[model samples]
Target: MTGGNWLGLSGKTIVVTGGSGGIGRAILRGALDAGARVVVLDYDAKTAEETAREADSAGCLAIGLGCDVSDTDSVAAAAEAVAERWGGCDVLINNAGILRPGPLEDLSLEDWTRMLDVNLNGCLIGSQIFGKQMVERGGGAIVHVASISASQPQPFSGAYSPGKAAVAMLSRQLAYEWGPKRIRSNVISPGLVLTPLSEAFYKDEDVRRARERLVPVGRIGRPQDMADVALFLASDRAAYVNGQEIVVDGGLSQTLMGTVPRPGYSG
Candidate 1:
């Protein structure tokens, strides 16, 4: 879509994990609209293929490859496929994650491990495998899709909070260790974004309004909000921006203390 002077991403190759839907899909669409070739790396073959077809139908260069982010072999194969097809990668968006919310005490060890495996470990795997390719090329960018849960704790979220918290630190570590190689690493923590997985919750008007109220912007976030940030971080515009976590929550996180008692304040 870009021909002259656009985000320095024209003709670049970007790989987005879990790109079949939700925020990942938005990122892929944003990249495609920015004239970048995108590869949808997802575990579900059907949805991945469907997404790829949709992109193609829209005149965007995109392909889908099934990948289980938690499995080493799966990630390696996906990287290899990208190497064979695109020669190498310019950006890697670690957006694949699983959230199994429940009380900590009631959550099983397996459940906790599963959450960490897909959320935290998956980031490491994708970064390591695809990062090596970037290191060989002497530079690249990685955008991890964490959540606001990483910073602010939420009750009944099992290990999701801990997993995302670890992902935040992991991105920083990658940024520090890989900066010398010119590879930039960053994090995008979204809050209250409606996706297929969470769309059902918004079915109730009261719940939707409640969520909007929590956000100081007076509305919930959209996938494009997070995607826009991801695109920025992936581009040269964010060359010096590394090891930083960008919260795309529409002023929600900043309102935590404000939600408390305000003796005489009644707006």
Candidate 2:
């Protein structure tokens, strides 16, 4: 089939942040393939437009808009535009974020604030803007793209982990407050997913194998792995699911303790 057959997202309008490429693009494509009219919200208008065109070619209604999630006015304007065009969004994938890796001690205040602003505050802003519409319309879903780092902190990752941790909590808070209106919110925490930005790191055979070894599944994750979870969270299939985080890390979290040397076990 030409379109996605994963869910009943046909004709639904979805707004995805940072959909110009990588995991964000994968999510956008998944929604489009599922027959949803998508909006690619990104800081770069050109790349967003390019992505939109590609989706449109696949017989999906897609648009690109430049938006800074940290800026309320920018987000409001984007929301207004979406409302005017698609009558309002049915789903929102708050996937915009940045990973500024550095030691917490060496990280500048500006870096920390920026990470929080984009990763945490960005999700809140998108939810509030689109979620208001969802509430008024009587129901909708918000899926956040938090990282597995949220729960398992990594050294030298700076504020990235902290910001994602807040995102997970933010999603839960929104779910608690918005569930009354039938608006569901959830978080998808991914681990070691291969994306455009990080593809180069995996080019080395040893590096790739080493990374894959860390996952109990014996392989790394793909963007589609996270996208599939996001689509499920946004669809009716997960109607009862809310205020929760679905870890898409190939059981890596489960093996954390096992990786440590045990008294009776041989390494």
Candidate 3:
């Protein structure tokens, strides 16, 4: 679908953090295709500008702004910019995050703090800043990009799962607290997705196939998979859906029982 405005997002303003690349970028494009003006927020200003330039086209407005979601001042400035340019944001997608792998036993305090700052605190900061705009506008949707690992802990990922878990709960808290204000908060927990950051791992054909077999859908997830769902959650069609965590893992999360050795139970 190419900016058909079927999602009813035409003229709506969308702010996406960490949208320079990966699933965030996919969501940015999806929002543009839905006919919404989008603002890309990334730590790297140059890359963000380049991405915005690439995604911009006729009938669609997209711009890039440098931001560190964990920094209140930075996000506040971005929010102010959005307000000045397009009045305020209609949809806020918190997709910026980082992963530092290390055993919990040996994880450094610095790494742990950094992960939480970006992965957990970042979401809260964005919601608070942009959420006010949504409140002033009467109502809006907030989509947080979490990870399936939020529920299922992944070893060697320093603070990643913990931070994500916190993010899920924080989203729910926001939903309950802000629901009466007409602001809806939701989370999207993605499974194993192949993004630019993880592209190197999938370069090995064997590695790719091995991972694909784990998902019941028989394929590794692409960025578009998450983007499709995000578009829905951000649209008015999902007005009734709030504070829910939509797991886009291709049924991979349900395979835990199948992982157990059931000799006679298996057909």
Candidate 4:
């Protein structure tokens, strides 16, 4: 009864990328709430410090780090700092990404490459950089914040979907390669969350309601929904879970709208 909790993540040190942004903030808060010492690594210095201040107020051991995860040198420096401070990495959440929405024909090659670099390459870099330590220190967990777009194709969202798809696969590959060393890797794919970045779509009452109607749960997802599951995947509760994608989409993926729309509407 005096041992670690069932989840086995209390007092663990967690490194989270993009922790200054919407979903990233949610994840940072959630991880802290779970009794983890969290490092909020982000590209923006001000926002990172703000996040650290807020988390500190909540009695969480947190540090705001400014680093470009897409840059290998920057990531290496950050990793070194973390290693020097945290003893050894226990958990890493690769949540840094960009959403450059455009049709394939209209998508800029630069933007496409950037998306792949951040969304896909960022996860890979973080995993490999921190993963080496995880392997050496016995083991750890890696969670990638992939999107529901990875599984369900999105219209007008070009590079984002493909990059996320690769993220899913990348997680699986890491799990396979690092399983022997005890490092676990998994992906959490979230759907339509009400984050600030998503305000544009939800700004219109009709649009928000229509999109909600599409979800089987009759509502869109919240960041906490994904973060709760993230808490598990990162913890020992999911010790057997690896190389898998847990879709947190409010049951929307299973429900197809084209087939059923009540008895009144028909083509």
Candidate 5:
């Protein structure tokens, strides 16, 4: 996408966690296309800087910093860097996350804690740190990239679902507590997206088709799909959209009834 000022983000400073790749990278690119100065925070410093350099080639002002969102000191440093470079953050996208698959019966405490640290605690930490910048700047928007598993249980995914579920609630709590401070918080729950992390699953044509059949849209989601929504949520266009969870699942969540045995109603 070409850089433009259509979303009124021309001079805005947008910070995206996990911005080195996948949906996070997409959001970073989208923000850049909208003419916003973007910061990429990822656990891998080199990868983050590479992504930033790529964006720079497109004439966008972007910087990549190593950050472990689960760590307060790491996040605080990243926030400070943003403040030093851009003065303050206008938008923050909490997109860094991890998944550890294991049955609940056999799940280890370490795995559970790790999942929560990244998926749940990371969100809070990022919000609190950058949120202060927003408070000082008068107001800002926060867009969290949660999973559809937040509402529906995905068995064998250890603490992935529970952690995400908490993130949804956390978003609401932040919205309520910070709305008065002009800090709007919202979440985007995505389903079946094809990214570097999930590319192995889609490599199998049969599995890919089977998954696609389950979605009403007849295809899996792309990073751009999530990025488009993030762009809107972070932009002033969605100023009134707060404490809300937008499910970008290609209408799959609404198809649960199709699995039930409804005999005489064949259309």
Candidate 6:
């Protein structure tokens, strides 16, 4: 795998939602590094600016866009902008998601809906809008960022897990419907990556070690780890890898850690 590149997306236009997030930025960087034009759609303008600047410095065409993937009108406008600016993207990476962590007992309906709005519905809307264009232009690729929580359970994972699980199923449905048009769809479930979202837990050495023990990989996931897989799924190299949910969490999912939370002990 190290001997050569996965696939070249040169001359391709890509749209990366939540491009400002930890893994989102990494995916954008990977695609841009591959000489592809990327449109970064992020909710936070500041973070989006940073991503766009980095891509621009790399001499790649990257547009920083503010978009609310949950809102119909918002997504419509964002998609329009992407189509207008890039004349349609060849790849659409739905990486935008929010984690509202709270005990199921204390969680509110508003919290649950918000999580679904951005995580599941957002991607669904993006797929419909962008997939139409891709289908018209012959074909395209869509890689969604799901979570191991979708399959495995974590404490206080109520909304996040269910929402992500829905996203995985959504990808499967989209794949089935869009495959005839050569529009491939896939999902990536990443485990405990050291991202801004998860940095609080890792900030404490003891906590970090405890978290690592839970992952059979002996360490938490990395942004680049997910990015590498994403690059493959988005490129022509993964043309045959459609409707598949590739869990890129090292060997964490394979290990059964049991009910008790044990620190510094990798199964």
Candidate 3 regions exceeding 4 Å error are 1-4, 57-60, 265-267
Best candidate per lDDT, number?
5
**Candidate 3 residue lDDT tens string, 1-267:** 445356788888999999986898899888887888999999988888889988985424998999999999999999999999899988999999999999999899999999999999999999999999998898899999999999999999999999999999999999999999998899999999999999999999999999999999999999999998988989877889989999999999999989787878873
lDDT of 4 by residue, 90-199 (tens): 89999998888899987899989998988899998989998887877889999999988998888798798889999999899999999999999999999889987888
TM, every model: 0.96, 0.95, 0.96, 0.93, 0.97, 0.91
Off by over 4 Å in 5: 1-4, 58-60
Colliding residue pairs in candidate 6: none
User: What lDDT score belongs to each candidate, Candidate 1 first?
Assistant: 0.89, 0.89, 0.91, 0.86, 0.92, 0.85
lDDT of 6 at 112: 83
Please give the range of 10 consecutive residues that has the lowest summed lDDT in model 5.
1-10
Compose the digit string of candidate 5's lDDT tens values, residues 54-87.
Answer: 9887534899999999999999999999999999
Residue-level lDDT tens digits of model 1 in 80-121: 988998888889999998878899878999999999999999
Go through the candidates in order and give the C-alpha RMSD of each one to the true structure: 1.7, 1.8, 1.5, 2.8, 1.5, 3.2
* lDDT (10s digit) by residue, model 6, range 29-144: 78877878888888876677777987687534888888889988887888788788778878999999987889999899999899999999999999988888898778999999
lDDT score of residue 128 within candidate 4? 90
The whole-model C-alpha lDDT of candidate 6 against the native structure comes to: 0.85
Poorly placed runs, candidate 6 (over 4 Å): 1-6, 58-60, 257-267
lDDT by residue for model 2 over 1-267, one digit each (tens)?
Answer: 134554778888899998886888888878877888999999888888888888787534999999999999999999999998889989999999987889977899998898899889999989999998987777999999998889998789889888899999999999999999999999999999889888999999999999998898999899989988999899878899999999999998888678788798946
Query: Which residue pairs show backbone clashes in model 5?
Result: none
lDDT of 2: 0.89
Q: 4 or 5, which is superior by TM-score?
A: 5
